[model samples]
Target: MDSIPNQQHAWVNLRRGEPAEALEYRADWPVSKNLEPGEALVKVHAAALNPAGYKLMKFLPNFVANRPLGDQVFGWVRSDHMRLTNQGALCQYAKVREDWIAYAPSNIPLDEVAGFAIVGITAHDMTVKNADLQAGQRIFVNGGSTSVGAIAIQIAKSRGVHVTASASAKNEAFVRRQGADEFVDYTTVSLPEFLWQRAEEGRKFDYIFEMAGVTDPSMYTQSDSYLSPMGFYATVGPQPKGLYLSEIWNLMKTTLFWHLPRVLGGPKAPFKLVCLDYQREDLEQLQRYISEGAVKPIVDSTYNFKDTLQAYERLMNGKIAGKVIVKVNIEDN
Candidate 1:
C-alpha cells in the first residue's frame, strides 16, 4: 500500500443540481484523518455509483448533506455503508466506523465488491427484515433491473420465494438472470392496471417491493387488489427528480395516501418505506451470501477516477442494469 497523503483527489459537490453541474474534481481536497474512537481509515481502490448518490446531489446542498463531497462507494475497505461522516468513497481515502465494516468475501475483487454495501444491505432489509417473506410466497419487485432490485430478486429466490419483477422489455433477460421467475415490461402497459388485471386473474403477491424510486402513488394506492391481505408494500421511497408539478402532485398524493386511514379510503394493505440502518449482523449475512454465491455483484460499467462525472451521467440516465464503478486507485485496478 502507498503512504497516506494529507491531501488527495476527490469529486466535490459545489451546489445542488445534476452531477455535471454540481460536482467538481479537486486534487487538493484534504483527506479526513480525524477518526472517532471506532473509525478506521481506508484507502479506497474502487467506488460504485448509486441512484441515491446523484439524487442527493440534486436535492440537497453541501452543508447539510452527509456525503457532500461525492457518492458513497464500497472499496478496499470492508463492505459497510458509511453515514454521518465527511469521508465519502469517491476519494482515495475514506473513514468508516468499525461497526459499519465487514470482511469482504475472499472470492471477489475490490471493484466488484465496491458496489455491495448499499444495494446488498438494502435488498436484505427489504426481503428479510421488512417484508419477512417465506418459502413458496410470491413477491413483486417494481424495478428488477435496478441494483437493489436485482439483489432483492436473488435474495427472495434464495429463500424459495417466487419473484415477479418489472423492467423494460430490453432488460427482461437481464432481470430474469437475477432469478426473477416472472418479468413485467413496465413500458408496455399502465402498471396499476396491469397489476389489477393480474389480481383479477387470481394472481396476488405476498409482498411488493418497490425498488424503483417511483414518485407516482397509484401502484401503491391500488395495491390492495394485488397484495395479499396480510402482505405489505415496501418502497425505497418516493424520489422526485425535480420540483415539477407532476412530481410534486405525486409526492403530495403519496403522502396523503400514506397517512390516510383505510376507513377513509386508504389501501387495505400495509405500506412501509424501507430505511437501511447499518448493522454488523446484516452486513455479515450479506457477506455470507456473497461468499456462497447466493448474491452476486454485477458491474454495469467502470471508469477511471478522472471520468467520474461521466460515470454519474451513465447512472443518472437510468438505463443501467447494474452498478457503475469508478477505479479510485488507478494502479490497483
Candidate 2:
C-alpha cells in the first residue's frame, strides 16, 4: 500500500440546524497514516449518505455538529482506524476497522454499492434475522423508497414473503421493480386507512417496517391496528422532524433514537428499533448477497467530493428516490 497523506480533504459540518447550513470542505485536515493492530487504511472511491447530517445532527451536541459526517463508504482497505483514530469515510482516505471492511463486488459498480453498509445491515437484520419473516407472511414497508426500505423490500421478497411498501406516486414503480408486491401512493392516499382497508380485505400485514422517518405517530404509530396479532413493527425511529426542518415541530421535537427490535413497545405489536449491528459474519453475508445479485445498491444521485456540501443540501431537501453519494477524487492519492 502507498504511504498515507499527512493531510487530506474532508467536509466538516459548519452549522447544525439545516444541512444547507452545515458543511464546508477543508483542504488541510490532518489524516493519520499509521495503522494499529486490526486496522486498514482505505482509499475511498465513494461514500453514501445516511440521514446522520441530513436529520440527526440537528439534535446532536455542539461537538458532533462540526465533525465530518458519513457512515457507509465503498473503498479499498489502505490501513485501519483503530483505538484513537476515528477517521470518518467522507475524507479522501478513510481509516476503517479491518473486520468492518467489506470489499465491493467486482461485478457491481462501486458508486451504487457505497450506500449499502449501514442501510443494508439494518434492513437485513430487521427483515430476515430479527423479524424472522416467513415464506407466506405479508409485510408493509412504510417508506419503501428509502435506502434501508429498498433493501428491506428485496430481502423480504427473496425470502418469499409478500411485500407492500409506500413510496411517492413517482417512485411507486421504482419499488415495484425492486420486488414490492403492493405499492401505496402515500402522496395520494391515507396510508393507515389503506392498511386498514387491506386488513378488512383479509390482507393484514405480518410485519410492518417503518422506514418513514416521521414523528407524527398518526402517520404510522397506529399501524398496529392493521397488523396481524403477531406482527413485528420495525423502525429506525421517527423521521427526524421533517428532513428540511420546514415544520416548527419538526425542528423542536426531533431527537436521536432507535427502536429496539424483539422488544415490545407499549403498542400491541412488537416493535424494534433496527440498529446496524453487524459482525464480520454479517458483513460476509452482505458480500455474498451482493455477489449473488440478491441485493442491489440504489444510488439516487452523485456529487463530486468537493461538492459534498451540495450533496448535503440535496439530501436535506428530501423526495429523493434512493441514496445520495459523493465520489472522492483519488487520482492524485
Candidate 3:
C-alpha cells in the first residue's frame, strides 16, 4: 500500500448548476482517513462518471438545507449507503464499504474496470433480479448502446435470453456487438409503433428494460400490443430534459403510468424502476463475467485529472456509447 496523503485533489460542487458552472477543482481537499469497522481506503486509480451523480448535483442543493458534503481505482471502505456522508469518487482516494468491493478481473484494463461496478450492478438487477429471465425468454432493451443497456444485453445473453434492442442507426453495430440478437433503429421509427408491429407478428417480448431514462409514457401505455401478458417493464427512471412545462407534463404523464392500476386501463405488464442495490455476490458475479469474457467493460472516453471538467462536459452531452472515465491517479494512465 502506498503512503496515504493528508490532502488530495477533488472536484467540488460549490453551488448548483451545470458541471462547468458548479464544479471547482481543488488540489488541497482534506482526505478523510477515519475507518469504521468494515471500511477500507482505496487509492483510486480511476473513477467513472454516472449521469445520476451530475443530475443530483444539478437538482439537490443540500441534504440538510445547508450542510455541504462531498471509486475505484479499487480497494473497499464502507457501504454505498454512506456515500452521501463520505467523499465522492471524483477525488484521488475513496473509502468504500468493504462488502461492496470486489477484486477487479485481471483481464480487464484498470481504466475500464473503474466503470464496471455501477453499470454492472444495475444491469444485474435489471436482467437477473427484477426480471429473473430464463433461457429462451425474450427481452427488449431501450438505449442498447448506453452502458447499462449494453451490459444488460450481455448479461441477458449469458442466460440464453434473446435480446432485441434499440439505438440510433449509427450505433446499431455497436449495440449488436454487445450481443443483441435483434436490433431496432429507434431514430428511424416510432418505438411504440415498431413494437406494435412486432406484436402483430406475434413477437411479444417477455421483458422490457429501459436504460435511456425516457420521459415518454407511450411505450409503457401501449405495451399491451407487444409485451407478453406475463412480461415485466423496468427502467432506470424517467429523466426530464429540463424544468420546462413540456418536461413537467411528460413527467406527470409518466408518473401516472407508474401509479395507474391495471383496472384503470394501464399497460398490461407490470412496471418497476431498477435501482442498483449493492450485493457482494452480484459484484462477484460481474467479476466472473468479465473474467470469462461474457461481458466487457465499455469505456467511451478517458480524461486526465486536470481535465475532469471536460469529462463531465462529455458525459453531459449524452452522446457517448459507454461510460465516461476520469483517471484520478494520472500515473495509472
Error of 1 at 259 (Å): 0.9
Q: Which regions of candidate 2 fall more than 4 Å away from where they truly are?
A: 14-22, 56-86, 219-225, 242-266
Cα lDDT of model 1 by residue, 258-288, tens digit: 8899999999888898987657788788779
TM-score of 2: 0.81
Q: Per-residue alpha-carbon lDDT of model 3 for 35-115, expressed as tens digits? A: 789866666677778776678763111000000121222422222343464467777666656666666677867787777
lDDT of 2 by residue, 232-315 (tens): 667777654534645545424332112323243435565576776667676667778888888887888988877776877788
What's the residue-level lDDT of 330 in candidate 2? 48
Question: Candidate 3 at residue 49, lDDT?
Answer: 80
Lowest lDDT sum, 10 consecutive residues, model 2, at 58-67
- lDDT for model 3, on a 0 to 1 scale? 0.78
Q: Would you estimate the TM-scores of all the predictions? A: 0.88, 0.81, 0.90
TM-score of 3: 0.90
